[model samples]
Target chain A: MTTQQLYEQIQQKQSFLCIGLDTDMNRIPEHLLQTEDPIFEFNKAIIDATHDLAVSYKPNTAFYEAHGLKGWHSLEKTINYLNQKHPEVFTIADAKRGDIGNTSAMYAKAFLQDMSFDSVTVAPYMGKDSVSPFLAVKNKFTILLALTSNEGAFDFQTQQVGNEELYKKVIKTSQTWESSENLMYVVGATKAEFFKEIREITPHSFLLVPGVGAQGGSLQDVCKYGMNDKVGLLVNSSRGIIYASQGEDFAPAARAAAQKLQQQMAKLLHV
Target chain B: MTTQQLYEQIQQKQSFLCIGLDTDMNRIPEHLLQTEDPIFEFNKAIIDATHDLAVSYKPNTAFYEAHGLKGWHSLEKTINYLNQKHPEVFTIADAKRGDIGNTSAMYAKAFLQDMSFDSVTVAPYMGKDSVSPFLAVKNKFTILLALTSNEGAFDFQTQQVGNEELYKKVIKTSQTWESSENLMYVVGATKAEFFKEIREITPHSFLLVPGVGAQGGSLQDVCKYGMNDKVGLLVNSSRGIIYASQGEDFAPAARAAAQKLQQQMAKLLHV
Candidate 1:
């Protein structure tokens, strides 16, 4: 989906929530475990319940990967389900994949061409060649790891390299690359206070902000400083929604959790 | 495997070769395409041919992930094959996964606990919390991306934040963490000259070096500066080895490529 499509969905749903499918097989209800693919069964139900309420579904690849081959099959089934049934919901592979040129090219082909995720998170550690491979595909995005929410984010990310913080410099310098027009970034909701500074660097690009619900980040605070005119924020909540309950009512609990956020998002969008 | 184990492997095999199983489906022989899972078929043949000749097998997760379910299954089968068949061969899931405490714990469980890979490549972008989670696991190594081979690695990695290069500070500070003994680093072969400085900070730790063949890095130069007394270098050749041939003789061709590197590594170890 295009950024415009994502923007339109946000406007239509009166929500800016991106339901993170950080699906854990062991965490899900035991009933799901009986299914052929428990992760897929849970995801299908969550997507079915929360599709209209969410602008996107961000599946952190680590979750599927944890279960081995079965997990990957679940991911494929879930993505295929989304494409077939709920095309309006954007998809983000919360996979921080970045390497050198040829490797990155294969990575780009893997996620963008093969799996067909709308966007994939990329680490900027290796710089433009690593990130640019993802941008080579049309309409897809390379969401660079800018200002993260984790504690260690303060290590080198916020440190002053020359004149500006390293994260800021990454954003500013990355704009020079080709296909950077399609570039978004991962600016954690915990770092919402720095959203203004982030905006000064890449005002128009979207930010895939995690660390909201279970991580104790405030939605209002994120919207206060992070939201653009285009509603360029995919605020993600994974554990808080997907694993809200470990019972058979997990899907409803998932819905309720997503609904509470969507309701808050509705108010934020002034629905 | 520990650095000690890796060192012994280098001595036993008379090589320091780490053949990267970056199995791109598009690049593999067309005959394998007839199979249900071409990636695994190609990898099985390659591993069968070169397992004893080489010490390590590094599977770049992107190549497996690109094919989605099939890719992941291939990864599982490949690793299981190694574990069951050649238990002595060191395995690495070159996934480059790292996050916050809770998330990193999940990632560790995914790649290390749940899956049977010996190590997982982690991006230290989030600093201590993100990286520490990987180290928390016993008997598993966290191969941190220290200095990569790509053109854009200089964008931030080589920048002097205070008195030291960002990569150096990361290496130095990483020593403060628990299970620092298991921490290996990825210092690209192209940056062979930086080995002197890197070794000064991390003398005992293993370095998983890439960028030898397809990226124009010299084996002689890397050994001259990078090799420790333990022969502590897991020099990776991905595309150069795996995609050595596109014909039915791909496995033999890969064996030849691996043999060439193994011979060079034997010399490097002796010197």
Candidate 2:
């Protein structure tokens, strides 16, 4: 999907919300366990319930991968369901994958071309060749990890590379790579202040912000500093929305959780 | 597997040679495509032929992930085959995966506990939390990307963070994380000279060096500078060995390729 299309969806929905499908079998409703492929079932319900409110759905590969072959099967089913049922909603395979040149191309083919996700998260530690493969895929986005929400972000991300901090360098240097226009970024919502510095570097690129509800990152602060005129942000909320209830009304409960955020996002967009 | 056990395997085999199972359906022999699961069949043959010649086998996850469900199944079968048939040989999942704290735990479970790989490669861009989860796994290793072999490594890795270069800081900073003993470093063979500076930081930790044949890095230079008292290196060569012969003689050809590296390693060990 084009960035313009994503922007149109955000405008129409009045939300740039990217609901993360970080689904775990153990966390799903007890009744769902009796059914075949509980992960897929739960995701279907949530996506159905909140598809209107959310512009995108992100399934973190780690959650599915934890269950091995069964989990991977669920992931395949989930992505297929989204594309088949609701092609308008952007899909993200939140697989933080990167490798050397040819190896990275294999991942690009898997997620972008084969699996047909609108985007896949990539780590920039390996630099250009690792990331360029994803960018080369036409009409797809490669969300590079910049300032992650986790406590580990301080370990190296904020350190000085030269004149600028490492994350700033990441945002700046990536712009010069082949097919740099297709690039987006994963900037944690927890570091709201850093968004100002990041915006100065790449004003037009969309930022996938994780850490809104459970991770304690304020959505308002993220928008206040990070938002472009196009509302260039994909604020993700996974656990807080999906696991809102373990009861039979879990889907409705998930809608409620998402709706709450969407209302706030709508208000933010108007402001 | 423990560091001591890996060292024993290296000494017994007289090779720290890590043969990468970067199996691709398009690249394998024509006859193998006739089999039900061609990738597993190909990997089984290669492992059977080269088990004694190499101390370790690393299957890069990107190759498996490309084919989607079929590819993932191949990875499962390949890892299972290695654990069952070649139990003495150390296995590395060349899956450069790292995420937030809990998510990283899921991947660690998938590869280290569930998949039962001896070690899984992780990216350090997210900092300590992203990587430390892998280190927390009992009797398993977390091979962190220090200096990769690709042209992209020069982008951010070689840039000065403070007094030291970024990759050097990666090697140094990772040592302070919890359960750091379980950590290993990936210093590419292409940057053979950097190993001397890397060795000064953590002399004992094993360095999983890639880029020998296919990427053009010197084995003698790696052994001379990167080798510790315990012969701490698992130098990997994927295409150079696996795709050595895409004919009826593929397995034997792979063995021959592995044997050449093993012989070179043996002479390096004696020297």
Error of 2 at A183 (Å): 0.7
lDDT of 2 by residue, A72-131 (tens): 899999999999999999999999999988899999999999889999999999999999
- Which portions of model 2 show Cα errors greater than 4 Å? none
Q: What's the C-alpha lDDT at position B210 in model 1?
A: 90
User: Alpha-carbon error at B260 in model 2, in Å?
Assistant: 1.3
Question: What TM-score does chain B alone reach in each candidate, compared with the true chain B?
Answer: 0.98, 0.99
List, for all models, the DockQ compared with the true complex. 0.73, 0.92
What is the lDDT for B8 in model 1?
Answer: 81
Residue by residue across B30-68, what tens digits does model 1's lDDT show? Answer: 999999888889999999989878999999887777676
